[model samples]
Target: MRIFVWLFRAFIFFALFAFALNNSQEATVRWFFGHEWRAPMVIIVLLAFGCGAALGVLAMVPAWWKHRRVAQRGGDIAPAVSDAPTPTEVQTPSGVRDGL
Candidate 1:
């Protein structure tokens, strides 16, 4: 399994390496005020992907904090029904029970 994972990683690395080598041409990014920035196409693509991912994570920060706060406070969401296991219920080793 480990060897397969390493092989997959190597394949990905070489593919990306080939892409970088093929796209070494300069790319231009023009800003709002006619400002232009130039860099390799691979770098531009990588930076764009990195910034988008970072922004996505940043956007989720508030929701994550809210969930954390609720969890720490024992989410008293809808009151537990008379029969079902509540969120704090202890379970078996597998943490699952067969319905049948």
Candidate 2:
């Protein structure tokens, strides 16, 4: 399984590398403040993709860290409370009461 995953990743990497190599023609990219910069089309696309991926990872880091911390604490967190009453308790039309 691990070998398959590695091979898949290598295949994707080579595919993207080939794409970048094939599409190295310079083109103008518009930026904020009416700025235009010339860069390879593949580089611009990859840069945008890398930035989005980085932002996604950054957003998940805090939640992932919190989960790790809770797991390391060894179940010190409070247990969930059940809405249903205990079997020993008696239910009345008005409310619940202690069982005889």
Candidate 3:
């Protein structure tokens, strides 16, 4: 399974590499206020992807911090529940109740 996953990843990497190589033409990004940035198509795509990923991680920071704070306080996300009988409720091998 691991080998299969690695092969799949390699296939994707080669495909993307081929795409980038074929798309090396210069591209321009027009920003607000009539600003412009120019770079290769592949670099622009990668930079946008990186910025989006950074924003996604930033959005999850508060939830991650909340979980960490709860952990530090020794709180269980889900409390344990025990339903098994106690030792005193067990029956002895001699056919007598242990507690009574």
Per-model TM values vs. the true structure: 0.68, 0.61, 0.72
Task: Put down candidate 2 lDDT per residue, 1-100, tens digits, no spaces.
Answer: 9999999999999998999899999989888999999999998898889999999999999988887899898765557887787866846666656594
- 1-100 per-residue lDDT for model 3 (tens digits): 9999999999999999998999899999999999999999999999989999999999999999988998999998665888878988966687666478
- Clashing pairs for model 3 are none
Candidate 1 C-alpha lDDT tens digits along 1-100:
9999999999999999999999999999999989999999999999989999999999999988988888899885455778967877956667677684
Q: Supply the TM-score for candidate 2.
A: 0.61
Assess candidate 1 and give its lDDT: 0.91
| Regions more than 4 Å wrong, model 1 | 76-100
What is every candidate's alpha-carbon RMSD to the true fold? Answer: 9.9, 6.1, 8.3
Which numbered prediction scores highest in TM-score against the true structure? 3
Candidate 2 versus truth, CA RMSD in Å, comes to 6.1
Of the pair 2 and 3, which is ahead by TM-score? 3
Better of 1 and 2 by lDDT: 1
* Higher-ranked by lDDT: 2 or 3: 3
Ordered from best to worst lDDT, the candidate numbers read: 3, 1, 2
What local lDDT score does residue 10 receive in model 2, on the 0 to 100 scale?
Answer: 100
Rank by TM-score, highest first.
3, 1, 2
